[model samples]
Target chain A: MPENSAGTLAPPPAAKPKIKPPRRFAGTLYRGREGMWSWVLHRITGIAIYFFLLVHILDTSIVRISPQAYNGVINEYKTPLMGLGELALVIAIGFHALNGLRIILIDFWSVGARHQRLMFVIVILLWIVLVAGFAPRQIMNIILEAQGHGSA
Target chain B: MTTETIPAPRSSYTPPRKRRVNWEKWGWLYMRVSGLFLVVLIFGHLFVNLVSGAGVRAIDFAFVAGKWADPFWMVWDTLMLVLALIHGANGMRTVTNDYAHRPILRKTLLGAILVSTVVLLVLGILVIYTFDPCPSNAIAGTLPAFCKAH
Candidate 1:
């Protein structure tokens, strides 16, 4: 409500400059750094995980056919290729989950917004740790299974 | 008693449709709530199934049967199946809304997602509940230790 020294009150400058359309398309407000990339990662990982969920449900339903049938299909998942695929699956899920938690924190916690970039780094670190813990063990299992030492 | 009079519409007014629930709000809440539960349930699932002894190699018919034989694991899996599927469906719905600009394509994609989510929910629940962890015809050694007379 403060007025200029000259006289009557005047409105402040527009909240933000109006964006002008370019003759041809350029980029967008997506030039935002860490937050933008985290959002992009979240969307991509989410879509990938959703599709995997559909396939996983269908594959698990093979159990309804018969024990032998289920084993026949599931054993294929133990192959080297599928093992690597599973490893990739684990990585995707880890990022989605850890980043998801960061999102929840940012939404619910008062201070979360101030430290969102830091939280993203934490999410990545946690995801890395998660992958590190599981990868070596799963890789070993893959090797053992491929070598025919799967006594299980 | 004096009451404030409300102004009528200056032009023709259409009556509002029955306002009941805000589905978009519900979807937002569902994402956060289900995401929280899935973080715990799915991590536990992975730890048991993948990080445990023998890892994925130990997963076969018997291993699954051994776990499902217990009522607790049965319920755990059922909760996980329902929550995770719905969460993924809702997330995909958001993605579709963002990207599918053509109205018909958007509707079709949304309809497909809805149908698939429902079908999978029914299928998964049926599998979890109706599962017979022990079959009568199974070979003796192939059965889990819990199955009687195996």
Candidate 2:
């Protein structure tokens, strides 16, 4: 240990202040930047789609057990409630796929890194077009069926 | 034993680099490969079941049974099930690693994902392979129209 001019041991200099990690909630949820939001949305949509796959597989498997059991489940999907759920599933899938493409491009292409934000904008635009093209018709069908004016 | 001698201090400290298995690299590659396949498989699946012929109305027990009867569709569906489940589970694992702060919670979530994925994959495979479109034990009215013809 270094000694003072008086030839006695000097007290150690004050320790440097410890740096604190960012709060978890603030780090994850409060950051509203495009990249952060995109990451959050990707995780949310991925989990949603995974759960949907579980139900879809189980329901489809019902057919092997018995036709009546299968029909009971499939027929329920024709309801307006399930139609809306289907719409949500479609939207989740569309976003996940498009964003996944963007991620792949960013990872593999040198140019993609420079213009990732541009790619994200394009993804949103395409998602809008896809939803616009599909939603109205599906919703209209559900409405008409509910009113007994169309085929179920 | 000799008397302890003071060691000289080193000028600097540096971590030794070691070659380790790059699981993340392989995982990233898998995501891209599986994603491309999924696009084709998923869209083809949707188009056939929802947009072809009578559209959604065409997707009854008979529709599914008819598709499963063909070896091509059986192969298609089985491949889709296996690939999609693995891809989705891997993606979820990445998410859990990123966000699950508690070690136990992370382990629990990952375990649940793995278990559910394996169970569903097995169930899906069994359903595709063992499907009995026209079971003799099926009640008279509940059977598909084609089953009556058989």
Candidate 3:
């Protein structure tokens, strides 16, 4: 071999061809993890809200349809079970709003990633506020009504 | 027939793993989990509001008043509201991030989503808490019979 043969050294052997790995389906359709799950919930809830909106509009439209019928439907909303239903709707709107703020931060600015946990905490705290504000009035009314001092 | 001889195998190839963390993984998990919860909340809400009793016909002002008369229902409704809202907002956020490429447009849309959701949530909670099934001095037919005590 020439003294400088190391330079050629058969070009130190050709590098192996790179192989592309198999595809990963982990996060497909936003089903991969927590944040994506939050996104999924958001979309699902949004659609649900829309669906509920249609029902609500039609239900309320009963006012134009017939006062008796409207009163009948409105009365149903006052049931204990239905009262709970309305409460859930309130919380849904709350979560959607707070998480939305978090997402807006992620999309428009870069701060979301740095404060994911904090944002989530804030979301929960706000929900607590919502509950605190609404739950008492409802409960108090219910109690008062049961006590024969109902305020309607 | 003449054929080429096969060559001997060399060393086995091992794949290298990168140290980079994956954010996409987390996003995927979020969608499935949130979606699972939403199914329960949405269906429960529908069943209670539209399907129970005399179907949709049973819902009305007094119907709502009757329901709100219970504290248990109050908490239930509150939970549903918070969960569904958060789920929806987060989902829209994903869509915005994926499609809204421009910074200004993305921020604006996100801002709009945030503002509308908050305003609606506030108004909704207020309505739920402040709901009055019957006001004082209302016509007899206009009020639920129980309002007489007030």
Candidate 4:
């Protein structure tokens, strides 16, 4: 706070950085614990779902093109490969939705912010239950389709 | 030496624009509100379409036709399409803002997101509403059972 003889404020004592801020695009991964991982996961899942939703609309629009055209396209979804892919899609969607709800609660509910880590655990548990229920059915569906029973 | 003038810290700062409305705040709110609805709507959609009946094998022209034949499902589909596109586009915008520091790249990406969102929204709603589940020209097996009356 010293002023020079010229009555001007003295320059800040040659500022030196104690620590450098992390630079973006340095090809270095910034590490974080649970909260950051959750954010990363949410973004990944969201991007995946967004892409799928776009394609889904395009494919569904095939119905208007012609019934046979739609059926031909939709039938591919029954294949074993697509069946497994659907499982992964469900998992992505499952996590995103559950985590999204957790986020909402954290913002809206008073105690939610206090117990975010706990809420994250519960979200995972519920998602597991959800996927557990759906996975078996999906496996069964794939199995049945493989066995030539398309009505499974 | 000249009286080196030093403007007060934080005094030189000026807002980039006069933001009359907080679009970002509204966008954030939209994400949460629409997300709540999407969870229920999407879960129900998955359960009914993918889990129930014969699973993926059950879907076809007839299957989709059967669902859209009902007004309830049409409304549900319409709502989901509108809400999900906006929510997703807003999310993408946030991501773009976060990482895409280059002005040209950022604007291009945001522009693409907006364009795609609008295109898909219009296309999806049109497809859902203007859909002819039972096309007169549709082959016999392609149409749903109720189409027998047609």
Model 2 spans with C-alpha error above 4 angstroms: A1-32, A147-152, B1-20, B141-145
What order do candidates take by DockQ, descending?
1, 4, 2, 3
The DockQ for candidate 1, computed on C-alphas, is 0.54
By lDDT, is 1 or 2 better? 1
lDDT of 3 by residue, A68-132 (tens): 66676765665566656666665675566567666656554667676665666787798789667
* TM-scores, chain B, all models: 0.83, 0.81, 0.70, 0.85
Give the CA lDDT, 0 to 100, for residue B126 in model 1.
91
The prediction achieving the highest DockQ against the true structure is 1
Candidate 1: TM-score of chain A is: 0.78
- Residue A12 CA displacement from its true place in model 3, Å: 37
Question: Model 4 segments beyond 4 Å from truth?
Answer: A1-31, B1-19
For each candidate in turn, give its C-alpha RMSD to the true structure in angstroms: 7.2, 11.3, 19.0, 11.1
What are the per-residue Cα lDDT tens digits for candidate 1 across A1-152?
24555344456655988888766533332346767888899899888888888888888887777777778788888999999888998899999999888888888999987778888889988988989998999899999999997746
**Candidate 3 lDDT over residue span B1-150, tens digit each:** 989887768856769877786867765555555555655665566567543554333445565566767776666666656555555666667778988999999999899878766765665566557656665534456555577787
Q: How far does residue A2 in candidate 2 sit from its true spot (Å)?
A: 61
Query: Of the native A-B interface contacts, what share survives in model 1?
Result: 0.63
Encode model 1's per-residue lDDT on B36-127: one tens digit a residue: 99999998998998888888898887888888878999899999999999999988888899999999999999999999999999999898
In model 4, what is chain B's TM-score?
0.85
Q: What is the lDDT of residue A118 in candidate 2?
A: 79
Give the Cα error of residue B30 in candidate 1, in Å.
Answer: 1.0
Task: Indicate the docking level reached by candidate 1.
Answer: medium
- DockQ, all models: 0.54, 0.30, 0.07, 0.53
